[model samples]
Structures are given as structure tokens and as C-alpha cells.
Target: MAKEHSLDLIAIGRSCADLYGQQTGGRLEDMLSFAKYVGGSPTNTAVGAARLGLRTGLLTRVGEDHFGRFIGEQLAREGVSTQGVIADPQRLTALAFLGIRDPDTFPLVFYRENCADMALCVEDVDPAFIRSAGAVLISGTHLSQPQVFEASLQACRIAREAGARVIFDVDYRPVLWGLAGRDRGDDRFVAHEGVTARLQEALPLCDLIVGTEEEIHILGGTTDTLAALRAIRARTDACLVCKRGAAGCSVFAAAIPARLDDGLTGRGFAVEVFNVLGAGDAFMAGFLRGWLRGEPLEVCSDWANACGAIVVSRHGCAPAMPTWVELQAFLRGGDRPFRLREDAALEQLHWATTRSGRYDELMVLAVDHRSQFEELCRQTGADPARLPAFKALALRAVDRVAGGDPRFGVLLDGRYGMRALEAAADHPYWIGRPIELPGSCPLAFEGSADVATELASWPYNHVVKCLVLCHPDDADELRERQERQLLRLHDAARKTRHELLLEIIASRNGQIDDHTVSRAMQRLYDLGLRPDWWKLEPSDSAAAWRNIERTIAANDPHCRGVVLLGLSAPEEELAASFRAAAQVPIVKGFAVGRTIFADAAEQWLAGRIDDAGAIDDLAARFAALVEAWRAARTHGAPADREIA
Candidate 1:
């Protein structure tokens, strides 16, 4: 297998829609809705391998419907080559409705009769494409149908002739095989001699075979595990891998003994399990990732186990797969205790790092302050009419700071001042719009009562920023109400595909300590609020920032890094904060409002400075902050430059 080749692995099998029930720990009858995600053994493995940095492709058929289109889109998003995946307008895509019973059990019903995948024919198989891949993996279910079986065998022959390794994943599902006199009670280990004989015909052509213990039982035509291993060994000289859930997986080379004790075992990671359905696919993808990369068998097993551990602790199969960086981070995280909330951050990293052309770092302009702007208006006794001019002045500051730098975003409230938001809409600058009401105690929205409904209409590229004034020590009733509102906002943001920025301001009256802000973050995660970005205040110490990072990892590993809030700090002090924040990798950018635009805004409002003069001052201040932030990132030093 040459690394220079285009495709590393091409998977052939079923591709379907997995309707996973949203309500955990409940039966399907009790669930009202299910989140749609791409599923199927081969598809999941392909997606997982792609996420782990493999140049992968899929050779399967999907229906002409949206589910099929969704599967194609997801594969494309994950960087998988979908040129081989055909669309069958004659048949619909397969579907599986899944429900979580417990950590060890998940109930699933397969609705795949004359599905598109089963309709695959010999004519659909691309010989040249299969030959180009370093390896071709075929799922066992493909052999159940005579037409698809012929196609699978043809792909295998073409791949083998081209010197590509042939791998078989015995994804044995008893219900899919219609054999009379079969004990339907046991779906795991159903032994039929006819099926075993049929599977054996393809075994001699395989260089590698993978299956769970029960799957092996069916493939070997024996209930005894050891007898099954021996039977497989006699049939083929291929490498065999036995998947043991939570106990990890074992690999046996052709020269190895049939017994499990003789095979190489990779210790499994100990983590809280939410669903066990997709763990096998994740493990297979991980194992192949290591094997295809020419890594040692032991290292492959470790990758397999770690990958499986990550999927079991989350939701859907393909979406839950970790990228190479996330896997490395998890392995490097050591024996430390990990919570499920923290997995979101890693998931974010997995999704973010795999994509092309993301900003290396961001230098966002902070103009999303409504309460402070109103306060300035109050202090100067200026009419609220002048606020629009002030906001217009802030736009000039954004333009100056963001000049020639694509890594800049502006946060402005559309409710208070629409001028800035409208001006920056079609501009190159990244825009984030605030949805929270000005000076709300437990949080309130200015427009429609439902913040989610209002935000649903916002542009996709515009980030929805929510500013919440919360305290860890707040009264229980107020905290509960706030949590409910925040969860509603979170659900809406996810459904609308809008990136969210959560700005949490600790209650001003409470005794502020290092742990206060981080604990506030953890509380939101506990209530199911996973924001893409967290707008935070400058921390007092290095240890405090580390605690915040840990908190982000636990609650939402997918969280974009935090941005430091100005809290109306003096320009010199805010500069120092930027230097401190740049030292933290988890701090990607800054969003400081008053420190950048306050002085100019006050001068313009009080009639001490003209409109042009105020605009110039604001732009200079904003540019100075941008310079200080870049310097802090490039050179490790405090922001010592005076504000001109």
C-alpha cells in the first residue's frame, strides 16, 4: 500500500439513515423525535477512517431521497470520496430506528427490505476504482443477496488482482438473513450451516477478517468460541481480529494459535458508556487506520480501543468518530477522570481540524455591548438618538482593525444598533449578532419572546451571541429558570445551524474568586448548553485559565476557544489582558467592547469631539489593540504600547 495513492481504503456495503432517539434511557414509544445521522457498518467505518486522516472512498448505493443526499453530504464534509456511491432512484435508502436501553444494551429496528444498498448489482461495481484503492473492505451483509453478493465478489477479485489487501467485516445481523427454524430469540449468535458455507467461499480471498465474538460464532458455524477461531484459521490464512466490547480487541496473525491467549490484546480505555451500538464500527475504523499507516499491530489495537471508547460515550456512529488529533489528545490525557460533557470539545476539534482553510487564529472586534452603551448615554445625559452615530463610529474601528486580516470577527447587537450589523452583513468581516436583552437578570430577549425563533431567521454566517448574567451562588429558583432558557437557546442554535457565542458575566454582587467563572461554565454544560464560543473575562492567574480550559474540554470539547471580555477596563490594562490570554491555546481571540470604543463614544456623545474626530480616535484605539494581540501571540510579552 503506497501512501502516494489517492484512496487508502474503499468500503463496500449498506448506507442508511440512523434515526437515533433524542431522549436517552427510554423506550422508542416514549420518544417524540429522533435526530438523523448517517449509519451502516461500512459507511460508519469509512467516515471514521476519514475523520482519522485516511484518504478513503465508499462503494455503495443510496436512495434518491434526502437521507441518501444527507449521507453523501456528510461523507463530503468529512473529506471522504463519494464518487463510488451510486444513487438508486428505483429503491429507497435503508433506515434504522435506535433507542438506548442501558449502557450495555441498545435496541434497534432495521427497516431494510428492498433498500437501495441491497439493490446493488454487478454493473454498479467499478473495477478501476476498486483497483486504485490500497485496500477494499466488504461487509458481510452484502453477501446475503445474490445480486449484491456478485458485485461484492467482483470488487474483491478486482482489488486482489491489483495487489490491494482485501478485508472483510463480518457485520452479522441475524434478522437480515431469512432462514426458517432459526431461533429468533438470539440475534447475536445464530449458526446456520448454509450461511457458514457461503461465507467460507469468500474467506480464502481475504487478507484480513474482523468480527465480534458472536459474529465469529455464526461465521465459524459453531457456538463454542475456540472452535470458531480454529474453523476460521483452517479456512483462511488471513489476519483475524476479535472485537471485545470494553475489554478491548485482540489481533491474531496467520501464524498465531487459535486461542485468544496467544493473540495480541490491546487494553481498553475505561470511560462512561452512553450507547454501545456504534462502538464496533469505530474500533474497526481505528484498527484499519493504524494498519494502513504501517503501524505496529499493538499500536493499531490501541487506536482501535481508543476510538471505540470515544464513540460509546457519545451519540450517532459516524458523527461520533474522533479525528487523529482528538484521539491523540485522549491518549495523552492519561488516566485522568473524564466526563461526557468534556467530549464535546474534542468533537469540535475533530470536526474543525479536519476541514480545510480555517483561520490559524482570530482577532475579533468586540462591539456587542448594549448595556454599557446605554450606561454611557445615561451618564452624559445625551439623547438615545446619538447612540446610532456612536455605533457607526465603532464600525469604522472594526474596519481599521480588520483591514487586510481575514481572521477578524465583529460582535454587535442588531437590536440596539442595526447600522453596524447591516453594514457588516455582506462585508468580508466575520459577524456575530447578540440576541440577549440589555441588562436582563436571569436573561431575557428583546425581540420575540422566544430567542430561538428570532435567531432562526438570522444569517448562517452570523454568530448568535448570548450574554447571560449568572452566578454559581445564585438562588436555586433563578438558576433553574436561567438553565431552561439557555437550553432552549442551545437547541435552537443547533437546529438552525448557527454558531453560538455565550458570554457569561458572574453576578457583580457575589464574591469573585478564581473558580467562579469556570464553575459557571460547568453549570451550563450540566444543563445541556454547548456554545461554540465562550466570551470570558480576563482571569487572575495561569491556574485559573487552565481550570477554564479543563472546564471547556469537559462540557463541550467542540467549544471554540474563549475570547476575553474588556469589562470596560482602561486601554493599558486591557492590553495586558490580551497578552495574558494569548499565552493560552484555548483562548483563540478577544472581544473587548468599551475599552476599544468608549473614550471616542463619550467624546462624540458629549459634543466635545466631532463625528470624524471620534471615528478616527476609535479606529486608532482598535488598531492598537489588534497590534498588541498579534504581538502577544508572536512575542511572549506584556502589551506595553500606549494607546494613541
Candidate 2:
């Protein structure tokens, strides 16, 4: 193998929030809601390359505001290095409000009058950072202005000096360059001599150049496609690639040919186009995946076309780009005119592969018991209204225990834990909100039964947790109903891109044995319900734990590990359970709710303890359990450790 570089690519340009209208086939004004995603050509390409398993980085500036921070965090989660991502205190992040009116017509408005990303200047380019990458990608959109243009040139200059490849994406948008109205951000091309002149200044420095037919026209300073290719070919010897929409793309490694199609080319996929906004970026990403690996040009075209085909069929750009696993699966093709968004298997792979927060050991606090909280209030003659604040207090205990580690998750409910959920929106901790109506036997969603819509209203940090008391020995009718509800919830989680943590209690119906839980898991996996996490009762022996692990590994190796449910067991009883699961790697940690918080909550409710006392009690108990779990993981649970 060749000596490796510190990074495969570093994309330089804008990174902002793209608010795509939730309701497609409508006007932007009439659209009620939008799904925000990390966008901007350079960042999109960076994210795409990262998803394709490339070691990528981004050099851009975003405001210190919420959206700006969101872009930074999102890039990091996508596995793109944010070392060059600067937090601009002076300017706010950019936003693009867009709507798909029809298959052909779309409306876009850029909110970048003085956005932070546009402030990228020559000073932001780090020569060492540029040299660390095998290649640097410069988006043409950054060439529209003086500051960003200089930054792009500085990056390109440094890349060439270091013998690193430079990739130029002729990502032309007339509105960005003032050739069109500010609102006409969707306008792909405007014939301007100055824009072409600006692009030409950086052409000699690039190793590979990519653009659409219209984009190439803008760069070549001509209306005719062939003439434009020839004109641009004269300025530099960089390999040219012209994106030809549904015709795939054409490559020119030697010289401009009489017919663009006469060059080495690959045909586009026969998939229906949903939106053309980010296909070019996806194409760039796919191309780089192979190019950086020294793969042949034909293979690169194959990847680029497949990536473009997949993204154009989806809603947003960055999120729609397929990971390496997803791309390879799509390349194995099932049928023509692919409906990628509706391909459940592919979409599932996308979710499984691209998601973050893979904790080495997850220690969750399961405080999402709605009826249990209400029952505690009822027994103590306390107002149910007070439960919300108590739930917040319980979350505070979790916060106190976690100290901002993402491994410490909280299974909360919007019914009473809304304050906690909303407050922890930006918290590093993993927050799971329950969807199952409390103690519902057959399992029903908490609100409106419209699980998808309910999930959509939830914050991105919230994972959808559903507890079902399903037994392997259930009657036919009951089993079918339970499976149906689970399937519904499963699909809803997929559509909303929410991670699912399924808690199954098999003893709910019949006599329990070690294999019963494994059987229930097998049934769910057979039904194609692959949850991100599993909350299961602790196994009494290592053999039972082995069965559980085999069942999970056989069905879905991507299954995020499991956590043991407390089931209101006493702290002493739970210690033994934790000891049994100590050798089982699948059992990440415990989500013991009542064991940790129930006593304190009851004390607070019955007025036996004040708020400070109750909070201290809860925090102490939670902290003890965490320590016990860690000890068990490290050196096995001590048999003589006294209960708290």
C-alpha cells in the first residue's frame, strides 16, 4: 500500500443550514414546515465523501448561533474533521428556504446577505491543513465574492505547492454572483464574462474539474456546449468532467472532443428525479471516492452516477448522500427507475451505517415511566402537575451523574419530561423520548396514533423508545396485533430518522424461561424490526446471555447493544443481575429507573423530604449504580458490596 496522507480531502467553501420544505410540491410561502440539513456545496461534498468512508475535512466559518453550531456538530457526527470549522462571532449562519413546486420547478431563497460562511477569507486557509489532505475541493460558488474567492485561491495554491491534487467543482449559481435576483437562488447558470474570468484564474491549479453542462458554459464563456468545453480546455490541462443530467457524465482526460459524448463516459441511472439541487455535489463525492483511491475513471463514473441517482431521488442533499455500504448496495441494482427513498432495505442500511453515538458502553437512566410517576403522585396525594418538575429533577440527577457524557442516556417522555427533553436539546447526553402509551398492554402510540407525525414533532436529539410486553407464547391474535403495532412504530422511526430503543419484557404474558426472551427477539428480527438499541431484562446466566448475543448478531450485526431494564427491582437484586451480565458484552449497561429515582421521588411526593434532599438522594443513588456498573465492567461486580 502507498504511504497514507493525514486526510483524503479537505473541502473549502460555505457550510450552512438548508431548510427544505417538508411539504413537497408546494410554494415556499405556502409550505408550513421545513426539514433542516447541513448544506452548501463544499460542505455537502465533504459530508458526502466522509459518508463514503473517506477521511475528510471542511474549512469554513459558521456563526456561533444555534444553526451555526448545528452545522459544526452535524459535520463532526458525519465523520468529517471540524478542525478547520471556525465559529464566527460577528456574523450569523446562512439559511436557504426552499420548496419543490413540481418535478421541474423549485423555489429557493438564500439568507446570506452577511452570513458567516461568506466571510471566509485568505487568512482562514491553513497551509499545513491543506498539505495534510491528498486533495482539496473548491466550490465555484465561493468564487462569486472577493473574500471567499481569495480563500479558495489560497487553498488551491497551497495544495499545488504541496503536490496535493486540487478538485474544482464548477458549482455555479447566478444569484450568488448577483447575475440574478437574490430570491432566484435556483438559477443554475448566467452567462457572465466576469464569472468565467474568475473561474479561469484558478483552473491551472486544479487536477480535476467537475461541472454540469450549464456550469461548464458559465466557465467556458460560451453558450454552445462543445465550444465551452474547448474554450475551457485551452486555459488548463486539468481533467474535465461535464455532468449531463440524465445522460450521466462525460470525462475529458486528453483534450476536448468534437462531440462531448465521444469522450470516455458513463450513462446515468434510469431513476426518477425528485430534485436536482445536490446531485452535482453527490457526484463530486462519488467521483472522489474512487479518484482518491487511484481507481479507474470508468469506476469513478459508475460511483458518481450511482451517488447522483440516489440523491436526486431524495429530498435533501447532504442527508440523501449514501454511505459506502449504501452506495455499494444501490450499485448492485434491483430494478430500473429506482425509487430509493421507498427502498426499505437500502434506507435501513443508510440509517444503520451513517448514524453516530455508538457508545462503547451505554449507561442509560430509564425515567420514562408515565403511569408509575402518576401512581406515585396518587399514592402520596400529590398534584399530578408537580410531576413535570419532579421529572426535570430526575433528569438533573442524570445530568449530575453523567457530567455531559453522551453514554449516559435518559429515557424520558414528553408527557411529563417535556421540560427535561427540551432543556437537554443541545446536551451531550443521549435523550430518548417514549412513544408507547404508558402501560398499554397491546402497545399503542402516546399521541394521536399517528406515530410518524408524532415522531416528526420531536427534536433530533430525542430517540424513539417503545416498550412492548410481548411474549413468545402469545396467542395468534394477540401476537399479530403486537407485531403490527411494532411494525408501525418501526416504519415511523425509519421515516423520521429517529433511533429506536425497543424494550421487551417477555414475562408479561406467560411462564418465563431463558430462551423466551431470545425467541421474542428472533420474532421481531424476522418481522424486519431492527431497532438501534434494545432494552432487555438481564439474563440469569452466561448461557442465556450467549443465546441473546447470537440472536442479535445473526439477525442484525448493526444492532446497537442492549441495556438491562430494572423492572423496579431492588438495588440489591439489581446488583446481582448486573454481575450476571458482566461477562456479556452485548449488555452495555443498566437503565434502572425506579431502583435509582423511585425512592427519592416517593419521598419528595409524600413530603418526607425537601427538594434539595430528594435531588441529593436521587443523584447519590444514580451515581452509585453508575459506579457499580463500571466496576462490574472492569473487575466484575463485588458480591459483598452493600446496597445504597
Candidate 3:
């Protein structure tokens, strides 16, 4: 039987009231539209673990004010035991102002002057709590303050003594420790230099060290991820896990070599991102989940990838976390198809130009018989001249799916003898184009390099290559051939200073084995090409949709939008409730089939949907419906109505 208090994760240090303001192209003093959310690295980790069904507790200090109450309540609601959370009546809670300029990054300003969290002393932490937990997790941020820092260190020591593993997250913030206080002279440069020194003090005691590439560099003074991991590992017996953001995570343990001879060492999974905030915490939560379950290091990396993927695909931190059911569903290939709106489409075009690195652009080439190609083009409203460019554009589109940005163009042609395009239909870069084959012609293009280079040169930060083979005889051959083409494309794209994405799509029900696809993908990994690939049957789409619908329906308050056969009262109710709970506008709409419905809904929600030249007509309609309901309720009130 599992222990009575099995696998309790105790998270300590640093709590803050994170105030976020959306930039509306105005000055900082203009009183921008702002939103407040509770934030703290430890708080986030605790909540993340709890959401994953772990017995978790948070030990931190907040002020006696309303913000402290809010933080306590938020943790409690997330199923995190806040018994160890203390309120400091003498000091105020820490405050951090976060400004979101884009989904990938944000600007932060901290206002923590002797904050309550910093007032935490060694006597505050309950020894029983430390002894009961399976692991005690702490962050390096608290080390800036002596009292709180000592308290956190002592707690970790106590937990370790009580037979609990110690997990240290080196979340280094230069500004926090950069201030020229009395004890440390006016050496302004000391703040940045002090981070590594402080981290070194805590390294020997930590059982595990989790950090990003940047954090690793700051801590170990090295840019190379592998070298940093080894350097840190040599100092402590702790396992070193370095997060590479979009590229995935690299894990190193003493028993395990840095690289495998069979080339099966660092595991990776490409993720679709919306906001990168709290992604590290999500990854830590995931890694801890696997570690608690006694899973292998590789599986642990996969969990971290899955958790980080889910968190970054949403807006906020705690609210964005997926439940255990949602994670399992996603792992089981139950994610819905990509959807796009006009604004997202335009943003993709803009993002393509502004961002640089990987091909943020996607290209989808649809191949099918004559009748299928013609019918698909007619249904999708794709143009014939743009058919050749559609494949590259669609591949770019898939990268932006997490942002709900529509960025691909569709085309229809009858040049190839195939019926429809052989591409992932749900891929963002796929343009829903279907080309009819004229007869057996040259399937391989002599100037494929030119096309590949042009596609790679798009303005997007990341480039993705998607290949879908619908022809039975062409599947195996196409898979190998496409890999070579992608490598060449990747080389060309890199020459132009862009990141290349090469994805292969196959049917799950087909003769192809998943291990074969994994092995093929592993080869790409060896070439430093980490791409997203999927193998699914035709009916997999419906199953994915059903899973999404169920998730939306069950978590109504958390679900921001609903896609059904068409807009209905049920969807409206869900949207209304989500808006009320999250305190943000909610979207309610539907897609007819996979393509048509998703496109329309994406545009409508993004305020780009046009019906009779009216932007957000569907959204306005829903708003009106909600307004009328409010009016009816107001009118239904009897005179005086003072029974209560």
C-alpha cells in the first residue's frame, strides 16, 4: 500500500501579487487596462503539482492585506494545502508588475521592499510538514534576502534529514539582488555576480537542480548546455535538468552518460506556445510527477515536455494548467485540429516577417485522385495559382496554432495525378488544398531546393516542414525521401538564418509502426532537427474533437470558448460562465466541419470574423443575448424585494 501521506511535495519561498497590464499602445502613466493574478514560483509549482493529483503543500509568507488572502484562497482552491503559508502582519506582500508585449516574452518590474515573503524566518517552517513530504522544493530568488534565505535553506536541510529529496529551482533574477544595500557597498555590479555565488552555496544540498539554459549559464558560467549540466553534476549528486524552451529539455544524471552510443540520450518534444510564463514551473511539476512515480529519466523528460507544452499554450499560469485527465488525453493523441481566424492569419504573416529562427511558416501539400482534389478545392475556396505555395504556408501555420493565429493560404490545382493533398489536415501550415493528378508525371521536382529555400526564407521565427502521403505505394518511399528533402531544406533554411521544422504524418491504422516513426524521428534528432509528427486514422479527428468537447463541457468555468456543430445556448452558457469566472471576455461559436467551422470560429473570436462586412458579428450577437438575459433578470425583480 502507498504511504498514508505518500509523495507530499513541499514548495517554499517567494510569493507575489502579479499585476499584468496589456499594452494598448499608450504610455506607462496612461493607466492601461490591467489584470491581477497571484504569482510566485513556489506557489505555481505547488499548484501545478496539486493539479496533477500530487499531495502538495505551500510554505510561504504574504502580507496581512487582501492580496495575501487572495493568494491563500487561490492555493486552497487549487487543492494545495496552505497550512504552511503564513501572513506577515508587519510587512506588505511583494508586488510585481508584468507587461505582456508578446506571447513569447514579457517585461517584469518588482516592488518588494522588505515584503512579507522576505520576512520569513527559520522558526516559521513547521518541521512536521517537512518530515511528511516526499520532496521539498525551493527557488533561488529567496536567497536575496537573508532571513527568508536562511529559513528556506534550513527547511531544505530539515526535509533532507527527514528523508525527503530536495529540488532546487535556480530561478535567478538579477534585479532582485542588484540593489546596493548598506551591508554590501555601492558595488552595482555585485548583484549579477552574486547570483552564482549564492547558487553555489545551495548546490551541495540540492538533490536536483532545474533551470533554463540562461539560468545554467548564470549558475555554471557556461553557454554550452551539456557542459553546464556536467559541471553542476560534478559538484552535487543531484540530477541536472536543463530546459531548452521550444527545443525541449536535457536531463543528466551520474549513473547515465551525457550521450548514448545508440543515440538515445536527450529526449525532446516540440511544443506549440502561446505564453511562456510559468512554463518552467509546469516542467518542474511534470518532472517531479514522474520522479515520484519512479519512472525512467526519459519518461520524466516526456512528462516535463507535455506539462510545459500545455502551460505555454494558454494565457495565465495557474489557470492555464491542464488537469490529469487533460494531460492523459493529450498523450493519447486526443488533441483537436488546428483552427485559424483572419487576424491570426494576418499576425502569422507579420510574425513570419518579424520573428527569426525556426520556420514559423508551414507548407502543406495535398495529394489525391482527380475527383477528390477538385471537390476539396471547391469546398475550401482555394485558388489554383497559389497551390504550389500552399504546402510551405501550411507548415508555418501549424507553429502558430497554439496562439490561435491563422496564417496559411490554400490553393487548388490539377497538375499532379494525385486526388487530394497528402498533408496533415490539422497542421497550421496546411492550406486545405487538393490537387488532381493529370497522369504519371515527374513527382520529384528538379528545383525543389529553390522551393525549399523560398519557404525557409519566410519572415517567421521558426520554420516547419510537413509531409503527408496519402498514396498507398508512396507512403514508405515518401517517408524516407521527405526526410532527405527536409534535411536539405533545413540546411538551406539555416543558411538564410532560420530554424527548420520537418514533420512526417502517417495513418495510425496503416501498416506503419510507431517505433519506425520514432526511429526515423530519432535520426532527425541526431541531425539536431526536432519536429512534431503524428500518426492517426481518419476517425482520430472525431475522437480528438469529442475529447476536446468533453473537456470544455466538464470544466465550464475554466473553458474560454466552445466549438460545437453550430452556436447554441449550451455554448453561450459555457462562455458566459467562463467570462464570469476568469473575468475576461469569452468566445462562443462553432465550426461546421473541421476546416470551415474552425476558421470561422477563430476569426470571430479574434474580432476578425466578418459577416456582411461586420467584424465580430457573432461575438456581438452573443453579447446581445447575454445583455438581454441580464435585462430580463433586472425586470423580474419585484418592488422592494427585501425578503432576504
lDDT to native, each model:
0.81, 0.87, 0.55
Judged by TM-score relative to the true structure, which candidate is superior, 1 or 3? Answer: 1
For this target, which candidate reaches the highest lDDT against the unseen true structure?
A: 2
- Which stretches of candidate 2 lie above 4 Å from their native place? 1-4, 335-337, 639-642
Question: Can you write out model 2's per-residue Cα lDDT over 130-242, one digit (the tens) per residue?
Answer: 88998999988888888889889989888888778999999888998888998788888788988889989998888899999999998999989999989888888988999
Candidate 3, residues 65-87, lDDT tens digits: the string is 98998898778767788888898
Kindly list the per-residue Cα lDDT of model 1 for residues 1-644, writing each as its tens digit: 44355899999988999998877887677887677888999999999998888889999999999889989977887788999999999999999888886775677778887999999889998887887799999988779899988899999998888888999999888777775223231256567887888787889889989999988888888978778888998989998998988788778886556567678988888888888878889999999999988999999999999999988888778877888888898888754445543555565565455433354577676767777778888988998777766786677767766775667878877756688778876567777888887778777776787776687667667888888888899999888887888888887886555777898888473876778889999988777677878888876466778888999887666566788887878867777777766777888877877777888778888889997888788778777777777787787444467755
> Which runs in model 3 stand beyond 4 Å of their true positions?
1-7, 23-31, 179-193, 255-272, 334-644
Top of the candidates by TM-score:
2
Every model's TM-score: 0.67, 0.95, 0.51
Cα lDDT, model 3, residue 116: 89
Clashes of 2: 0
